[model samples]
Target: MQVKTFSGASSQEVLAQIKAELGADAVILSNRTYRKNGELCHEIMAGVERPAQQGGAGMPVSAGAAPAPSSGAGWSEWHKDWMRVKEQLFMLMKPAIRMERLTPRQRVALEYLQREGVSDGVSIALYNMLAARPGASVLESLAGIVPIRSWGAAAWPQRVHLFAGPYGNGKTTAALRCALRLRKEKPEMQIAFINTDCLRGNGRLTLRHWAELSDFGYLEAADAESMRKALALTAEADAVFIDTPGMTPERNLAQWQHEMGIDEQPHATHLVMCPFYDGVQMQALLHRYAADGDTSLVWTKLDEAVCYGALVNVAHEARLPISAISYGPELKQSLSPATEPMIWRLIFKRQLPIQSGE
Candidate 1:
């Protein structure tokens, strides 16, 4: 990998420079903002895979060309070695899971968490915590890993919020519900909606209808230039909620955001998801939507899920705080700001956030 650092007056400027030098396949490693010479500036570190050499001539291979015959075998061997190491580690840890050391209640709770789909790694961590601190409860241990950051003006002070997720994950509805909640809490706040999921007629219409009915500003942007224009027009609004399209197999969130100019601004991106997806699918979605900016998780369709194990797994894996959750079929009154009590109820008690009036 070829890594480099870039700094400029704005994130957009630095991002443009990185792309110009490293092309579209660059991966952002880190980014920060600081005052340089009495002026605010953004710095970004990015890396890209170096092109493979061909024919011993040091010539770079084209992206679409076939790789050397040995490349597939090399990758297969590497994967096998990795799996063996993981298996060995798990084998070593299995002997330490002494269920008899815990009280009957703790044992049952730990067993239940395992049945609910919590991974072995997290269960082991919880076991260690309980064994070290006999006074701590299972809920306390879980809370340390699964954090909650309630969604509102106080928790999220950013003016622009972007909602992105897989197809049929209810990103549009979540965005609308957030806007409604904001309007109810702060009636004087000027809110706007920016739609980038133009490929779906139903979602686009729904966003436009709600924005018009609520008397909030609304615009549609299909690409970077239009998005720039839309942002410029909504610059006066107190808050802007952007609804993004679901990522296709050919597209990536980071690259798409960079191309649309969304990464250039200071904003928050919420990854909307559902709890019904299996662990493998959830991991794939998380990997696909990973971003280097302020991002949080928004779970939807809690009312339809049979097991909430994916929730714990995702929180432990992504380390992103839960921002909000949605249940039921209604757009209004179905979404709630995530809190520890609410999350624990859903995971341990099979209770939805809206059920407890959270």
Candidate 2:
């Protein structure tokens, strides 16, 4: 793991520097504006965590350690403070439907969801659930309405994991993160990479670079025949990641499968997305990318998203399960298996989950 602080003129410049220095797997700890040399500049703290280069026991290792996860007490206090601010903000506005006996906090919380891009009906459902169960309100609201499916290493039923999503949605980065995490946990296990995204030259180079660094086999395939040969050749590996180019449902799913020579055995597709996408865009993407029940949702760019309700709302409405989430440009601690509390925090809290922990 390596950590560094970079100063630049703007947010984009700092992020580019982080990505360039730490690669896509780096995680951002903090970003702020400060005066450097009597000039206004932005500072960013970023880090990278990789599997131990010369280790056998699979010990967790990182170059830059981030702040510990917020304790339960601290999280509660932050929620309470946000509630107060929200109540004050809404006090100036009139309620569309006045319901007696509703607490100000409850009303404000409802508005918060609306602002987070939830539909009116879905927001009302969440409000009613929270109102009925004041204790552990967020947990109760999500448990009954949405599913947080687990995709930890133990959940991999197939040897071939397929990553597919819209271009620029972070599929390549997600693949690297997942691959490294798996290797870290199971050092003795055999791993390999099979890239089907042949059209993207830069993406192919990035995957190959990681392969060279990690000392794993990397292969590329363009069509069904080549993919079939790649799989047959890597049959000895325990797990293989198959990365594809941007796929949309508007295209022929069957034809695409045929072109890739995809088989039912030992294969599963995961749709990767950024949580900042609005409801309409998400629905369109899901309709095209995740039409099958087997496809699970993996969110990226959690730090960039101002709110996460729309992502959850789309999943709930479509009956899709959220399998994982990635928070920043840094690959270290960028992705994690999804959980109920995680969804709750992403919806209500401004801070991103800062670590990859239990």
Candidate 3:
């Protein structure tokens, strides 16, 4: 495994630098802000591959290095501490272990168990899994446990494209990519790009950019009145690609539902997701987006990821049909619809290659 250190003025800048050079597969080892000279600067250490083991297994164990025998009182105290931890885990898991909804942490622990081939003692296994994957939370880990359903047929051509997800998850770019692809296939499809992202940046740009290049009709809406107008305009058009605002729907599904005017009819709604995020975070993001009932998924940043576990997990959990995949910033050619075989290859058929630092 190769470990690399990068220094920059800020954490975000340093993260971008490392990702650009080492790609997104690099695991972050540690990040800290340090005083360099007189200025506060960021320092990040990342690595590829797992850490080396402490010693070879061939060496015999040394009994002389073992800890001295503990007194009776000390032994009792240690045993009590172990029992307390055990009880806490049980209490924490008691409600949801069988509850239909799985939290991200529990989901990750389950995935860890699957990966490690551990068959029993879920509580202990979960603890050990958390220990190995620090910063991984129950909510984030469980997002992968989304259920599956048979999306027997797609209702695409008849409907406009609806894009939604957490902030900065790339909803706009994905929508534009879809618009571009549609333009190639049906030049006179009467498509309109609707910008529901009233906030700064994000989906607004993707819609605005595509509208500029292709002369596609553009609409902006914030409240129910505007959205109603946009929907009416879309009624006459062949397709309406709606770019929604990026919001984290953790505690308030109302905000998303209200903002999107959830009552309005949409041809298709796709949850745009980035591959670079951690497993637990990804799950939490998915859960929040999947709140709109049967929304589909569109995975972005494929060229930037290594592990395909999250992709598999999201598909299984949300039971959302995968609409499309956007590889890069390219227009028409960069987009492709999601397929079952494509997913199978990512997990079972392909051996991810190691990328050397550029």
Candidate 4:
């Protein structure tokens, strides 16, 4: 038995990271929630034990396996009680193990069940309610509850590429990288980079560097008319990428749409994702971003993460075709179009390798 440890803000995050490193068939041994470094964290300890070739019991015995000293007559009854509890937990978690589709929150609930020795009936009742409601968190559903999935370029439409996400998700940097990539790929093609993030100094500096290096057109839009006029001019160019500030769920998305003039010829919306995020939170975050139609996913910092479970959930639920994925901070050349087989290898194990152009 090989044991591994992981820590994350949520169980979904931890599991996603683990799956990315260990693969889907890895067995979980134990999981628990604990406070760490001033934040609530989930600590999961898992084991990756190979299964037996033939159909046989594969449970690993404890190293110091020995009968415990107990009341002489009561040992048998105690053992039966423990076995019953274990059976209940196994039953409760079996559904999740077999489920082909599970939300991040649902995934967390299943983990909790596996850890807490919950009954099968309890797990079912909770899961069913969540299935019916469809909006509650996974934890909420399991407590009887619980809650809670980018970008592509091809023949740009002289239209601006809008980058919007929560703060620190790396929007401005990506915009610059994309610009450089476009310049390298088609030097003759006219390209422009627009920045709407006037409030951030980093945004301005990044755009400035792009302007100097690529000799590509750069525009700034402080007002709707300016943005509209800029769009009108850029519409003549081969492609225009618009970089917008990271907005929150609290702001009126409609107002932002109106201000950014997104209502007119909507540009490709790319949802930038950090690999460090847990599965459940990632789904919730994607949902918020996807509220606006025509949104695709751009997975960022793959070089920094081990698990890709969030990627799996995003692919499954949103049914959003992943256009490109980025591994690092290099210019747009660091990003590549995500293919089905690449995604498969990232998720399920035992994937039969298929030849490209097949």
Compared with the true structure, the alpha-carbon lDDT of candidate 1 equals 0.80
lDDT of 2 by residue, 1-358 (tens): 5779988986667766765665544556666788878988978786665545522222232211112112223433333333332232223122333534356666667677778777644655565566566543555666766777766568766788888888998999898888887888788778889988888889999999988788778999988778888989999998898888886544533346656767544577777888766644664565456433366778888777767776657666566788888877777667787787777777777555674244
Using all chains and alpha carbons, the TM-scores for the candidates as numbered come to 0.76, 0.66, 0.54, 0.54
The clash count of every prediction, one per candidate, is 0, 8, 14, 21
Per-candidate Cα lDDT values, in order, are 0.80, 0.67, 0.57, 0.57
**Model 3 lDDT per residue over 175-244, tens place:** 7777777777777777787887777764467568768878788988887888888888767777777777
Model 4 alpha-carbon drift over 4 Å, by segment? 1-158, 252-254, 291-293, 348-358
Give, for candidate 3, the lowest lDDT window spanning 10 residues: 61-70
On lDDT, the stronger of 1 and 2 is: 1
Cα misplacement distance, residue 69 of candidate 4 (Å): 57
Name model 1 segments beyond 4 Å from true: 1-88
- Candidate 3 error regions (>4 Å): 1-155, 249-255, 349-358
All candidates: CA RMSD in angstroms? 15.3, 20.7, 20.2, 19.4
Model 1 superposed RMSD (Cα): 15.3
lDDT of prediction 2 = 0.67
